[model samples]
Target: MHPPRANRAYRNVARVLRPVLYAITRRDWRGTEHLPVGSGFIAAGNHMTNVDPITFAHYLYDNGVAPKILAKSSLFSVPVLGWVLRTSGQIPVHRNTSQAGDSLRAAEQALAAGECVAVFPEGTLTRDPDLWPMVAKTGVARLALTTRVPVVPIAQWGPQLLLGRYAKVFKPIPPKRVTVVAGPPVDLADLYGRPLDAATLREATARVMAAITALLADVRGETPPERPYDMRRGGGGAGADGPAAPTADGAA
Candidate 1:
């Protein structure tokens, strides 16, 4: 019962991927009731492996929603893949150029048009040695505040079994079971209507990350790290060129 307004290209792509999706993985999605009824919301989740994006899209589609992603702009440079992205109404993000806000504007347009937008706040995969969530960027924060839409914090596990951040291995002999759980919409009412300053955005981003981390902890039945991984300072976090930096499929 997915919303019927999804672009024809999106539906076509889904039909093509449905068979392959079932071949390599099993899905366990909770918090189905938390999904917004119609549209105009963001689904923000942790980044672990490249496979999670499609699987997460599967999750959303199965729950009667279509996913429009904020993908890297470089992906739009490809011939065939880029065509699919454009036809499906997916947004491209310019991570390097001064025009990065273009991606946000595109996303805001999608949200306003009643499209369900998905984003990964951790600009890259977690460099955490233990694969826990690390510090995240404020893109999701900016999106939510600007549109005043619900930011649903989601957690997904087991995609790493099929493909991990640093590990290029793909072991699908038995078909791994991936668990995705969505928590309630993050509350940013107090932060709303205020100036979109770094401090406010940081606070909103922390709340979004905390909610996702808590759901992830529930999925793993373990406690998360006290601090998020910091890749820039070269602390205990894994290096960007570390195991998870190779491909951009599950890219930020």
Candidate 2:
């Protein structure tokens, strides 16, 4: 199915931010060949810095896909920026609230409508001091399993260099080098048609995180730890984890 056409509000925002990003960040984007054109799919990326959404969106926009991002609820209340985000078809996530599920429902609807939905499964910036992707929420897995759409694993490096994690200072002077790589859709066929229990969700989320970590490893040229960092436990290893290799074409 063909995704919905890009709205003018998004185009206008892109027009304004694209040149700024182009002027400041030296992009080393790869894996555009894995993006599913003309169809709805989830782009699950690692969360590094606050500026990541901008760079991630820029990459998608330049690739001819205007993403419907699942952004934090607070961002939606930030004066004029909120209005622009709402008008541009961005979904607001109300974390740790009764309304948290609202974003997931909205994301499902966006997928059904054939709109590309970008998600940061980690939900927040990595607590892993090294900026490696930490254990992520299971929302991306739930969305992929329920919607049965491709969940393309995307890893981004260097946004934290431009603007440090949770830091307010923006350093655009040196023109930081940002690398964004998109791996093929994760293979979840074995997990599909199964019950959506906690075990199932964890397995699926693990796969998503593993694929993202591998891509980031390739970009950074370093082997990842045996396990992803589990934020709940405040640690550096979630053993029993393995890489989720991409599936054959047309297999979700």
lDDT of 1 by residue, 72-170 (tens): 777666665576567767777666567656777777888898888888877667777777777677667877888999999889899888876767566
Best by TM-score: 2
TM-score of each: 0.87, 0.89
Pairs of colliding residues, candidate 2: none
Candidate number of the best lDDT: 2
Give the Cα error of residue 205 in candidate 1, in Å: 0.2
The models' CA-based lDDT, in order, is 0.76, 0.78
Per-residue lDDT for 128-222 in model 2, tens only? 87888888777677788999999999999988888898787889988989889999999999999899877788799889999999999999999
| Candidate 2 error regions (>4 Å) | 1-4, 78-84, 239-252
RMSD of 1: 4.5
